[model samples]
Target: MDQLTQIIAVLGVFLYWLILGAVATRIVIKRRSIGVSFSWLLIIYFLPFVGVFAYMLFGELHLGKARSSRSKAMYEPYGKWFSTLYSHNSHQPDKQSDYAASISKLCDSQLNIPSLTSNELELQHTPEQILHAIINDINHAKTTINMEFYIWHPGGLADEVAKALISAANRGVKVNLLLDAAGSRQFFKSEWPKAMKKSDINVVQALIVSPIRMFFRRMDLRLHRKIVVIDNHIGYTGSMNLVDPKYFKQGDGVGEWIDMMVRITGPVVPVINTVSAWDWEVETNERLLPAFPDKAQCTDTSSLVQAIPSGPGMPEEVIHQVLLQSLYQAQKKIVITTPYFVPSEQLLDALVTASLRGVEVNIIIPRRNDSTMVKWASSSFFSELLAANVNIYQFNDGLLHTKSVLIDDEHCLIGTVNMDMRSLWLNFELTLAVDDIKFATKLKGLLQTYMDNSDRLSHDEWQKRPMYRRVIEQVFYLFSPLL
Candidate 1:
C-alpha cells in the first residue's frame, strides 16, 4: 500500500510539471497581449488541471486548417471584384485633414476595399423604423434579397420580415437567408425554417455547433454581422438584430434597446453584398456571384463609405487596427457608444492617451446590463479612464446597444463591432467607415440625443463605491482578457 501511494504521487507530480511546461511554451509562442499571457500563466500555475483544459478550449484560435485555407481562397475572387470596381469609379477627393485621410487610407488598405464614393446613407434609429425599412426593401426586391443576422428570433419583428421574404421568393426573387447556428437556435427550434422552405427560400446556418463538429473548429467563433441586401441596389447594416428591442432575451431588466441601422443606396450596396455573399459561400460551400449595380441608378452622391470585416479566419485584426488609427487621429473629441466596454489594452491605452492630449473622450454604456460579470469588469477601468479625463456616461433610459464611434466630427464608424474582447478577437464582425461631414454631423446629432438621455459619472462618485464592490469588480476585471 505504501509503494502504490508513492507511485501515484510521483505520477501526479509528473503530470503537473507537464501541464506547466506546455502552458508556458504556448504563452511564449502565441505572443498574445501581456495581460492575457500573464493571466493565463497565473491561472495555470494556481489551478491543478482545470486551467489547462480551459486554455486548450478558449485560449487559442482553432478554425481548422481546411476552413482557414478555404476562407483564403474565397478572398481571391473578392479581391478581383474590388480591383475592377475601383478602376472604373473616379476617386473622391480627400475632404479630411491629413490625419483623418491617413486613417481612412489605413482602413482601405486593411479591408482590401476602397472608400467608395457616390453612396447615400440614411440612419434609422428605432427598431420599428429599421424593421419597416428592411421589410419595405424586401417587398420591392426585383432580382435578389440576401439576409444575414447573428440573431433572428421568431417574434413579431422576425415573423413580419419572414413573411416578406417568403412573398418575395414566391415572386421568382432569389432569396437567401443565413443565420448564426448558435444565435438563431431558438428560431430554428420552431417551424420558421419549415415555413421558409415551403416558400422556397434558401436558408443556411453559419458556424453550426455540434459535439462532433467541435473537433474541426472552435465553438466560440460566431458570425455576428447583421446585413441585408435587396435587389443588389439597397442594403442595411447596423447593430439592430431581428429580435424586438423591448424583449431582447428572457429576462432583460434593462428597458428596450436603443439601436441604429443605416439604409444604403448606390454603389456601396454591391460592396456590402459582397460580404454577405462571402459569408453565405463559406457556410453553404457555394459561391454567390456578386450583384452588379445598374449604371443608370447610380448617381453622384458624396458619402465615402468602406466596409471592414474582421474574424478569426482572417490573418490580420482589421477592425482593431482601423479603430486604433482613428483614435490616434482624433483632434477634438472621441465619442463611443457600445453596450460592452471591456477593451483591449491597446485600445484602452489609445483612449487614455487621446484624453490626456486634450481630446474629449466620452464613452456611453448602459446603466443596466444583461451580463453582471461584464458590467463589473467594464467598471474596473473607470478609475484609469477618469484619471485621464475620459468622461463616462451611464445611459439611464435603457440599454444603449449601439456600437458606434465619432472622431472629431470627421469620421463615423457604425455596425456590430462592440468594444469587448469577444467582438475584437472571437466573433466575426462588420463595421462601416464613413468619412463624410454631412453623415458625421447627422450621426453626431444622434449621439447628442443619447447624451441627453444619460447621466455623466463623476470621478469622485465612481471612486466612492463600496469596498466589497470594488474588490469583486477587480476580480472580474482579471478575467476581462478572456471575456
Candidate 2:
C-alpha cells in the first residue's frame, strides 16, 4: 500500500479503538456507581477533545484524606461530649408546639442541634456586616483559625482580610487558609506578600489542574464552599466569596452582590472545622485533627445550629434529599431563594406537586443572573411553575446569591447550597438547619424583604415572553441536569 493509504488505515484503527475505549470506560464507571459519570461521558463523546480535556482538568474528585483524618482525630476527644450533649438536649419532652406540626416534623433533625442550647447566632445581612464579623472573629482567635472560600482576591476588602489573617498568624495562632484553585486562580498567580509568607499561614488550593488530565476536565467541578472557623468555637458559612466589587463589577456600573451569612457559636463549629480540615488535607496532604472548643465558663447565647455538609464524598446527597423531603412535607408554604435555580426533575416535580396540593410555594431568583446559560435555564422553569400556581419572584436590585428555604414558618435552612446540579452533586456545600421558632421567624422576615423588592411573575406574563427567548430557555432546560 502507498504511504497515504497506510496513514488512512492507521487513523481508522485509532478512531475505532477510541470509540470502544470510551464505551467500555462509561460502562465500568457507571457500574462502579461514580456520580455523574454518564453525563460526563455524553460530554466526552459529543465534544471529543474539548469534553475530555475539561473533565480531566476539572472532573477528578478529591476526598481530602488529610483533612478527614485530622477531623476524625480532633473530634475523637469531643465525640463523647457531642454525643452526650446531643442525647441529653435532643430529648425535648417539655417542648411546646409553636409552629405547624408538619413543619416541625420536616426539620426535626435540624432542630435538635446539640450545641444551640448554649450558643448564640447573629445573622449578618450586608457585606459590611459580614466583613466586620469575620474580622472580629479573626481578631478574637486565640488558638487557631481556619478559613476557606471559593474566591479570595488580593485587593480591597480581601486585602484587609489577608492582613488580619497575617496579623493573627503572627500572634502565634495557627492559621490555615484553603482556597479553590479555580476560584482564586488569579490570586495564586500574583505575587504573595512577605508578611503572609512569613506567618505560619498554610495556604493550599483544592483541585489543582494537572497536565495529564487537562483534556478530560476543566471547569465542570469546583470546591464552591465558603467557611470560616475560629478557635474551634465560632463558625461562619454562607454564599459569600472573598472578592471585592472590582472583580464582579460591570463596566462603569456598580456591581451589586447580595449574600446572607450566619455566625454560629455552638456544637456546629466543630463540624465546620471538620469540613475545613477535610479540604485542607485534600489539598496539602496533611492530616488535621479536630480542635475542640474549650468548655464554656459563661452562658452561651447562640441558637440551635446544625452544620450539615454534603458533597460527592458522602454516602448520599443529604442536602438534596433533605430539601426534597422538606418540599414533600410542606403543608402551608414553601419558600426558596437561590441564585441558580436549575434543579433536578425530582425537585421540580416536588415543587409542582406541592403547589398542586394547594400549598403556597414561592421561589426568589435574581432578575439578571451572572451566568447567561443558567439564567436561561432558570427562566425555562417559570412557565411550568406559574401554571402550577407557584409564585416566582425576581430580585430587581442585585444578584441574589442566598440559598434559603423556609417552610411554614417552622423549618428554615440557609447556607452555601444552591438550587443547582453542582451543589447537589459536585461541590462540597454546607448549610445550617434551624428549627428554632425565633430563628425561623427572623429568616421569614428576611425573605419578606426580598419578596417586597422582587417582581412577581404571573402565568400570563411569563407565557407572553418572546417565542425566541422561550425556545432558548427550553433548549437550556434540556441540559439543565448536566449544568
Candidate 3:
C-alpha cells in the first residue's frame, strides 16, 4: 500500500507539470504583453492551483463573444458617424500647433476620433464644485440627461445628484443613467436606482456579473469612464466618480479623494454624447444615436478637442500609444497626476527616455493608495524612474484621484484613463485630447498645486528602503500585469 501511495503521488506531480506545460503553450500562443504572459507563468509556477484559476479568470481580454459580435456589427456605423460629425466642423480651420496636430492626427487615425476646434472648457476642481455644476446642469436639462460612471456610492452629495436626476425625470426630461455592475455594486444594492426608475429614468447596469456568467465574460473588464451629457450640449468628463468624498472610504486612512472635472461646451459635446450613446446602445441594444447632435450642430466649436474612447473591443494600445507620443513630444515639461501608477515597460521607458533627453517629467501620485498591490507595484517601478531623473511625488493631502497628463503649456490629456494596466488595456475609458493652450495652462497650475502638497521621492532614499518592503514591492511587481 505504501509503494502504491508513493507511485500515485509521483503521477500527480507529473500530471501537474503536464497541465502547466499546456497552459504555458496557450499563454504564449495568445501573445499577450511579455510582462503579462510571464506574470501568469510565474503565478502558475508558484501557486499551481491559484495561478491556474486566476489565469482562467483574467488571462484573456474577452469581454464576451456576444459583446464582440455586437461591436463588430456597429464598428462601421460608429466610425462613419464620428467622421461625419467632424467633417461638418471643417469650416473651422485646424488652428492647432504642430505638436497638438500630430497628437490629434494619431487619435484620428488610430482611435478613429477626429479632432474638433473652438470649444469652451471650464476645469472644475473639488467635489463641491463638480457636484454643484453637474447638478445645476441636471436641473436645467431640457431634452435629455445622459450619465455613466464606474462607481456611484449612495450618500451625501451623490444623493443630491440622485435627487436632481429624479426631479429631471419627473419634469419629463429623457434621463438615462448607466453604472458599472462591479464598481457600483453598492449603488445597485441601494435604493437610488429604484428611486430613479420610479421617476421613469432609464437606469441600466453595464458588465453585469454573476457566479455562472463569470465563465462567459471577463468580469474584471470595467466601464471606468465618467461621462454626462446634458441636453446634448453640455458635457462633463474627468476623474470624479459618483461618490462624494466626505462619505466614501473615510475609514481607509487615506483622506478624502481629491478630484477634478471639466465642463465642456461646444461641438465636442456631441462627440462626448455620442460616445455615451454608443455605450448605451451596446449595453441595451437600444440605439440613442439619433439623440446625439446632428452634423449641423457639430459645426459650432470654440476650442480644439478630440474625444478618444478606448476599451476591450477598441484598439488596445490607443491610449498607451498616445501617452508615449505625448512623452516623446514633450520638449519642456510633462506633469502627470494619477491615483494608480502600475505602468507597462513601454510607458516606463518613455518616461525615462524623456527625462534622459532633458525633458522634466513630474508624476504625482497619492501618498497612501487605496490598493496595497498597486502601492507596492508602483513603488517597484520607482527604482528605474528615479534613476532616470523622473520626479515622482506622493500627494499627502488625499488620494489624488485626478488622472491628467499636461504636456508643455499647449497640450493636455484628461479623462477617466489611469496610468495603470487595467485602465490602459482592459477597462472602457474616455480621454479628451485638448489642443487649447488655456486649458493646458489651467491643468498645469492644478498639477502644480498637487506637487505643492506632495512629498518627492529621492533616488537614494528610495533605494535605501527596508529590504522587506523592497522584497514585497518586487513580489507585487511580478503581478503588476495582473493588477
Best by lDDT: 3
Candidates arranged by TM-score, highest first: 1, 3, 2
Candidate 3 per-residue lDDT, tens place, 1-483, comes to: 999999999999999888888988999998878998888899888987888777778888877877788888888888888777655643243577787787777877886777777578899998999999999999999999999999999899999999999999999999999999999999999988788888999999999989887898887989999999999889999999998999999999999999999998877888888888888877888878744354433323355777889997787789988888888899989999889999988899899999999999999999999998899999899999998999999899988899999988779899999999999988999988888776787888888889999999998888788999989988999999878
User: Please, what are the lDDT tens digits per residue for candidate 2 over residues 406-444?
Assistant: 989877888889999878877878877666667788888
Residue runs of model 3 more than 4 Å from their true location after superposition: 1-16, 90-93, 291-301
Show the lowest summed lDDT stretch of 10 residues, model 1: 292-301
lDDT (C-alpha, whole model) for all candidates:
0.84, 0.72, 0.87
Off by over 4 Å in 2: 2-117, 191-194, 213-219, 252-254, 293-302
Winner of 1 and 2 under TM-score: 1
